[model samples]
Target: SKLFGHLSSNSSPLFIMPTGRTLTRTEFVKRLREVISSFGINSPLYSGHSLRIGAASTAAKAGLPIYLIKILGRWSSEAYRRYISVSSSTISNAFVLMSKI
Candidate 1:
């Protein structure tokens, strides 16, 4: 799986120093900024978490089953339900049934 593959490739040592040091959040952000700059994206709209939200939102819009999305995102069922809940407009449209009086 992509997650497993990423984890395998991103291994780090327990003690991160000059010889075996882990990157701090600031360093990670700097590296991300450098990559974005390299792409010449002056105003990138998306960040790392954007990708996660995008995936969940896309799946919801596409009408995929919520359980499948939960598995894909590794979210708890309640969290997944909250994540994919539809807007008022969508729910109203879906259930707007009228019969002749």
Candidate 2:
């Protein structure tokens, strides 16, 4: 399947699996491991779950409101906090702003 193109249900699956269905957790894990290996990453902590966390964290870093991030992530409860992460740069910037106030 093409990596970049307009996609519709009639087109190739947004993400293809050898079995042509939803990927099993085992398959997802294997693929993530391979990609991480290719990148020479040495962390044991990255997986499919990281994608969700990264997306929520990225939206937060981009300054999107928490309510909107929750909605965009389909999070219905305060559990959204578990998915988002704040970076050190953001922490430092907040401290700088606070000091000026």
Candidate 3:
């Protein structure tokens, strides 16, 4: 299937698995925790929501507009605004750019 210029096999799962079974919430979290621990990250507070928020923050930092981020994140409401984590440097850069206008 073609989606926004990305091609995906219809029969393949987004997250490939040898078992060809979908991952349950618990299983996904367990795998996520394992990966985090392997990377020496001690925080156990990371969850699926963390990934969503991180995506939003990262997109914002990359200079993507909020609307585009919302679309990319599949956010249906304005609540995605809360997910953006703007840095001081980004704010200063924005101001610098606006000053040139």
lDDT of candidate 2 at residue 67, scale 0 to 100: 80
Tens digit of lDDT per residue, candidate 2, span 36-74? 988899636788778778878898888889987776666
Each candidate's lDDT (Cα)?
Answer: 0.63, 0.74, 0.77
lDDT of 3 by residue, 1-101 (tens): 25623422243334546888877777787889889989899748887788889988898888888778877777779988898887898789889999999
Off by over 4 Å in 1: 1-45, 85-89, 97-101
Comparing 2 and 3 by TM-score, which wins?
3
Clashing pairs in 2: none
Top TM-score model: 3
Candidate 1: TM-score?
Answer: 0.46
- In order of appearance, the predictions have TM-scores of 0.46, 0.64, 0.74
Q: Which residue pairs of candidate 1 clash?
A: 16-20, 16-21, 17-20, 17-21
